[model samples]
Target: MSKSCQGLFVEFVKCLRESDCMKASVEHRSVTECAKVSEECAGLRYTFFRCKHGQIDPRTRIKGNKGY
Candidate 1:
């Protein structure tokens, strides 16, 4: 991915953290997989990912924010 896209993902994760929207027991998954599954899981946005080799990547967005 390009640097700008990576930066966006990081920022999105940071926003989730700042808003307390991420889950505690979430396991890291690929960005592609996360994008696919996020819609199915309530309140679970793509926070980050780790590849088979343990490389870390992150993606983020708000979920289950019914009050706001």
Candidate 2:
């Protein structure tokens, strides 16, 4: 991931930690919508990336369908 994308993910995690409503609300939005909000809040352009199973969930032994 790019630096800006990493930063946005960090900020999104922080927001999830700070607000109970945010977590619940985010579930209502699609993944793309969530990424758009994160990018806009961080003042960065969004880029879509794919993550294989091990790259995302290390605990998972199976590998497939890990993109968002």
Q: What is the lDDT of residue 65 in candidate 1?
A: 15
Tens-digit lDDT string for candidate 1 (1-68) = 53424554565455444432244325655444544544443233432322211223222222211111
TM-score leader: 2
**Which residue pairs show backbone clashes in model 1?**
none
Quote model 1's TM-score.
0.28
Model 1: how far is 16 from its true place, Å?
A: 0.5
Clashes of 1: 0
Q: State the lDDT at 64 in candidate 2.
A: 35
Prediction 2 TM-score vs. true: 0.29
lDDT (Cα, 0-100) at 8 in candidate 2: 46
After superposing all C-alphas onto the true structure, candidate 1 shows an RMSD in angstroms of: 13.4
